[model samples]
Target: MALLVDELMTKQPRPLGRSLILCASALSVALVTGCTSDSGGPSASASSPGQQQKSPSNGSDLTDEKLGKQVEKTLDTAEVSDSDPLFVEAGLERVGDGFHSVPDLTRGHSYKLSVVCVGKGKISLSIAVKNPVRQTLDCDGVTFRQHLTSSAAAIKIDGDGMPGATGMVGWRLDKADK
Candidate 1:
């Protein structure tokens, strides 16, 4: 039977100073050893910090003119009507050879893309678009949400993850009839 630490420590007949020291030493060891390693599965992405830090690019670094043309194409393909404007920063951004580029708007603006009233105000804009990536919380739980932009009663959603899940969502105002 090894010495029962608790019994020995508490059954002290020593001076006040030594008893206090022994108690503190025990507590410190317990606290330090409390942390345990996790056995969860692997992480989502294994890309190193270097790759992650690399600025998002559209592949080919387009020149000013090429960038303009690419951005113009997005609006042309998108539901940007006369009533709504895709206000360009630096007039517009360039598209990468790869079909992607850094996001333009910083969120918090009134500008919109009409998708209902075609020709200039279409209601079939970007509602219900999926999110680019799914959002996740540290197990506490997170509400799924999609990116949304509104024009009048219409809304344009863009991105690419599942809707109504524990991730990002996407949806439009739904005014194709109007």
Candidate 2:
């Protein structure tokens, strides 16, 4: 009976020991994760007196980056004159987006321009599609949606509030696939 009692006591400790070790490990991990996580906690450096907190991502892009890339890929970057043999300046047209007016795209010729993402929050990109291909333009992101048509009256490209950057917006030309 004494031996039997001793055997049971030994077996009880095996499970209890394992449980205690597991509990300790879990507690350690919980403490570490809570301390090291990036949940807007002030860094040790920034927590110092007279130091300010830094922002996470600049929040530069949302939807316009993807759309602007698509536009740039479809257009060409070369400049052509109204009488240039490779392509002709069919005309310029305005693209409208609610309250903002986009740059003028030339038809009868493909033009390529660049795009940029503004700082954090709102997305922005600019393109300079030139006539006679003569200018490197800084433009605004909201202006790309204003493509009226090549046949419209000579529309002007407005670079209002455009960041100083540039990108390839899109191209215009006939069905020749140039």
Candidate 3:
């Protein structure tokens, strides 16, 4: 049995360390802006220390811009530089889901996908490309990244926020380092 298990492991070496690295990066970003329980409002603690706290949405007082800035920083940290010639899409939903599409991608080219979500509830994301990828993010906020080789002309991102989910979601796709 041990030999059989070893054979299987050799056949398919798990990306155990890669997964840990991703989780660590996410946690580090989340730590920068503490997370709070969803109570139908944004918490000042969620804002970066020393910065003016702003709610994601407050009727006349919309704060999506503020969250976008934070997500930008997260993306930059992940090496998805804004200066890069790439497809970038980001936005905030007061409540419910969000969607974005990037067309005219170079098929078969390697690309890096970076995503970050901040706010409340669970944000389920579906990246539809030649090879569809799905991920669930805690609205508390964190940056997650993945590498993919394009197999389609376009990529669609569908962020389905679980019931009562409210937050900002940002994504970037850039040419991966060879």
Candidate 4:
């Protein structure tokens, strides 16, 4: 009877020890996940004290009215004559890595492509045709223009922004007489 009683005591302790370990494991997991969870924490755009914060577009600066005005201004500044007609006037909204393509371009014609950002951010534009090219522009209300010697089937404009940035870009394409 003593032996039986001793055995029962020892087995009870084993289960109790297992239960303690299980509880500890569960607690550890909870702690780890709780720290990593996204509960409205500071995002990548957050900057430290005394650090210059970059102004990245968040899609609010380029409203429809604003974008339309910008496009009209750019076209006017481009001075498209009767010989050169406007091909495309577009507004692009980009977040992170985004692209816009200008389709149905004619070959062997002189073309001008212009882009400007309507908000606070930097936009990088690129042309993809027979040869690929790249350009970076600031959103300080300046228009960037590029002249194309040959017609391309499409012109690809790529927008690169900072982490968690959503910006608006306006573009115009003019076709020159052959």
Give the candidate number with the greatest TM-score.
3
Point to the candidate with the largest lDDT.
3
> What are the TM-scores, per candidate, against the unseen true structure?
0.21, 0.22, 0.55, 0.49
lDDT of 4 by residue, 1-178 (tens): 9999988878755788999999999999999888755443445334455545555454454463465466457546434454544564444544343557655666677777777665556666778867788777676557888777554355565656544444456666666545
| Better candidate by lDDT, 1 or 3 | 3
Model 2 over residues 110-157: C-alpha lDDT tens digits? Answer: 433222222222223232233222233233433223223343344343
Candidate 3 structure quality by residue, lDDT tens digits, 1-178: 9999988878843599778888999998887645543343543454555555454565423556566666767766434446656544344443254756564567788777777777778778888866688888887667778787777456776677777777677766667776
What does each candidate score in C-alpha RMSD? 16.5, 15.7, 24.5, 10.5
Candidate 4 at residue 22, lDDT? 95
Enumerate clash totals for all models, in the order shown.
24, 17, 0, 1
**What lDDT would candidate 1 get against the real structure?**
0.31
Q: What ranges in model 4 sit over 4 Å off?
A: 1-68, 76-89, 92-99, 151-154, 164-167
State the displacement of the C-alpha of residue 150, model 1, in Å, after optimal TM-score superposition. 13
- The CA lDDT at 108 in model 3 is 81
